[model samples]
Target chain A: QKEVEQDPGPLSVPEGAIVSLNCTYSNSAFQYFMWYRQYSRKGPELLMYTYSSGNKEDGRFTAQVDKSSKYISLFIRDSQPSDSATYLCATTTSGTYKYIFGTGTRLKVLA
Target chain B: SAVISQKPSRDICQRGTSLTIQCQVDSQVTMMFWYRQQPGQSLTLIATANQGSEATYESGFVIDKFPISRPNLTFSTLTVSNMSPEDSSIYLCSVALASSGNTIYFGEGSWLTVV
Candidate 1:
């Protein structure tokens, strides 16, 4: 089984809709969770980062981590066409140098 | 955030050839990583490049196929040796300002097409 499992979605949503992206992990050692947005032909940019269980909000983006259940999620509100991109869930141990990434969920916010 | 620049952002290489992708960072960092992103797959770490020493590779990845060079804290190179069609993928250079933070920053990536 893969360490990190994420829904491989080409999920389409109309503008202003709420979009939810999630990932699950089997490792209990993972202490930091991150969400990255990757545009076509471009490198991924960090959207949200959380170290422990709880919720963090930044504008239209919200990141939630459930360390007890080993799950994390990113919710995007008031989605726009500019939000179309691949969302990758990544996790890492506190002191480790490498991060384990999910397969990424492709999202398309239609105008 | 550190600014990373990768040369030959995209390239086409013939089989049995090699391509060296260069990564230059604007600031000094301790650890540099090379990753391969295949279509429809997550990023797989190729190796960890540390200056003044050999790179530490992940399982199933060997130095013979992917030789990495970390000549300094701000620069590194990953050369894909004996390229094949299966070797075609996006090669990314990454670094974390703090190892414990795990806050990684990636380069634009070198998209290589091996034919």
Candidate 2:
């Protein structure tokens, strides 16, 4: 099984709607969870990262991690067309640079 | 954030031919990483490049196929040998800054289309 797993979703949502993207991991050693946003033909950009299990908020995006369940989530509020892109969740240990990335969920926020 | 530059941002190459992708960082880093993102797929790490030593590749990746060179702290190169249609993908160079709590950052990837 892959260490990190996520739904490969082309989820379509209306503008200003709330969007939730999630991932699950099996590695208990993972202590850092991150969310990345990537546009077509572009590289993944780090949106937000949280240490261990907790919630971190930045602007309209919130990242939540439940270490007990080994699940992570990213919530987007007031979504816009400009927010249409692929969202990827990555996990890693605290001291390592090697990160395990999920398959990413494609989102299209319609105007 | 460290500024990263990749050369030959886009390329179309014939099968059996090899192409080298260059990654240049504005600042020196202790470790450099090479990742591959296949069409519609997530990023997969190819290898870890550290200066003064050979690269350590991940599973399913071999040094013979994806040779890497880290000659210095700020620059590295990955050469895709014997390219095939399946080898077409975006190659990205990344770094983690310890000063920034080990946040990983990526460069604008080099898009390759193997013909």
Candidate 3:
């Protein structure tokens, strides 16, 4: 199994809908979790960062990590068409630069 | 977050040719990484470029195929040698800033199309 697993969903939703993207990992050592958003032909951009098991909120975006279950999620409240992009989940242990990235979920928020 | 820039934003090269993508960071960073994203795929780490040392490549990636050069703290380059159609992908330069707690920032990416 891949160390990090995410559904590569071309999930479509209407604007203002709540969107949830999730990833699961088998490594217990992972302490740093991150969410990245990438548009067409562009590189991934950091959207949220969380350490260990907790929830972090940034405007309309929220990031949650569960170390016990080895699960991480990014919630987008009132998602917009501009939120149409690929969301990637990445994780790393403390003091490590190697980030294990998931397959990414492609979200399309329709107007 | 450090500002990262990559050159050759998009390119089309013939098969058997090579392309070198350059990465520049606004500030000095301890970790500069190279990543590749194929069409409709997620990012795959190519290698880690450490200043004043050779790059450490990931599994399935080799130095001969993707030679990396880190001349200084704020600059690095990755060359895709003997390119093929399979090599066509978006190459990105990423940096892990100190303040972001391992949050990596990526460049706009260098899109290459090998025909």
Candidate 4:
């Protein structure tokens, strides 16, 4: 099994709809969870990263990690067309610079 | 996030030719990394470029084919040697900042089209 797995979603949703993007990890050592947004032809920008577990809220975005289930999620509330992009989840273990990234889920929020 | 610049934003090269991609950061950093993203694939890490030392390459990646150079803290390069069509992809350079649990910062990327 891949260490980190995510559905490569070409998910389309109407604007103002809630969008949920998720990833599952098999490694128990992963402690840092991150969300990144990448637009076509552009580099990924870090959206948010949470240490440990639980939900972190920033504006209309929330990142939730359930270490027990090894699942993580990013929720976009009131999504806009500007929010259309690929969402990537990444994580790292103790004392390592190598972060395993999931195959990004492509999202399109249409107006 | 740290600011980064990559040269030759996009290029189309012929088979058997080599392309060297350059990365420069605004401030000094300790760790530099290279990643490749093929169409419809995740970002696969190629290597960690260490200043004044050899780069630590990942599995399926080799120094001969993906030679790396980290002459100083803020600069590094990756050369795709003797390229093939399969080598066409987006090449990105990243820096891991120690302060934020080594949060990675990436360059815009150099788009390579090997034909």
As for DockQ, the candidate ahead, 3 or 4, is 4
Report lDDT (CA) for all predictions: 0.93, 0.93, 0.93, 0.94
Give a tens-digit lDDT track for model 2, residues B35-114.
Answer: 99997677899999979899999999999999999999999999999999999999999997767786799999999999
Instruction: Name the lDDT value of residue A26 in candidate 3.
Output: 97
State TM-scores per candidate.
0.97, 0.97, 0.96, 0.98
Per-residue error (Å), model 3, residue B60: 1.9
TM for candidate 1 is: 0.97
Tens digits of per-residue lDDT for model 1 on A1-111? 999999999999999999999999999999989999999998888888899899999999999999889999999999999999999999998778689999999999999
Candidate 2 structure quality by residue, lDDT tens digits, A4-45:
999998999999999999999999999999999999877788
lDDT of 4 by residue, B1-115 (tens): 7899998789999999999999999999998999999998889999999999999999999999999999999999999999999999999999988776757888999999999
Model 1 alpha-carbon drift over 4 Å, by segment:
none
Error of 2 at B75 (Å): 0.7
- For model 2 the local lDDT of residue B47 reads 97
Off by over 4 Å in 4: none
Model 4 per-residue lDDT at B10: 94
| Candidate 1 RMSD to the real structure | 1.2
What lDDT score is found at residue A37 in candidate 2?
A: 97
User: Which stretches in model 3 have alpha-carbon errors above 4 Å?
Assistant: none
lDDT tens readout by residue for model 4, A46-83: 89888879999999999999999999999999999999
Interface RMSD of each: 0.8, 1.1, 1.2, 0.8
Return whichever of 2 and 3 wins on TM-score: 2
